[model samples]
Target: MSALLAASRASLRASKAPVMALRRSVHIENTVDNVLPFKAGKHNKGKVAVGVTAFFVTGLSLPLVAGLWQLYVPIAHARSK
Candidate 1:
């Protein structure tokens, strides 16, 4: 009887718990600092821009490449057959 009651309580808690969700992080401020000679202003603009662009492209490309690989595998297999 105790085992059955425990199982019921576990089910109730599982049902009540919230589902986990992924969240996108937001950057509100300049995270870079002391490491660089120039922390802010016009001098760092081009460098910062290129770094951000490279980071953004790498971030975007990874998922796209994975999805394309997933799509490509079936075509490759069928061609092999």
Candidate 2:
């Protein structure tokens, strides 16, 4: 029983060093910066902003309009009846 406990403790201590080294090496400061798909240049800044805004507006409006149409259809049918 004592030999088994000593072997387990030795294995645990051996495993701990690699885990500590990994924790020290894996830091946010050492990490690479996230790459962007396109570079933001001065000439295309406005274009990028407009494109993003248009994308969000269209993306959001489509679902809203669809839901409003769905609500309106039921109301219209009830009124016609």
How many clashes does each candidate structure show, in the order listed?
A: 0, 0
Instruction: Compare the candidates by lDDT and give the number of the best one.
Output: 1
lDDT against true structure, model 2: 0.78
Provide the TM-score for each candidate, comma-separated: 0.49, 0.50
Sliding window of 10 residues with minimal summed lDDT for model 2: 26-35
The TM-score of candidate 1 is 0.49
How far residue 33's Cα lies from its native spot in candidate 2, in Å, is 14
- Per residue, candidate 2 scores C-alpha lDDT tens digits across 6-66 of 9999999888776556665633432233233554566677888998999999999999999
Name the regions of candidate 1 deviating beyond 4 angstroms.
Answer: 1-38
Worst 10 residues of 1 by lDDT: 21-30
- What would the per-residue lDDT of candidate 1 be over residues 3-79, giving only the tens digit for each residue? 99999999998888765533446435555544444555567778888888999999999999999999999999999
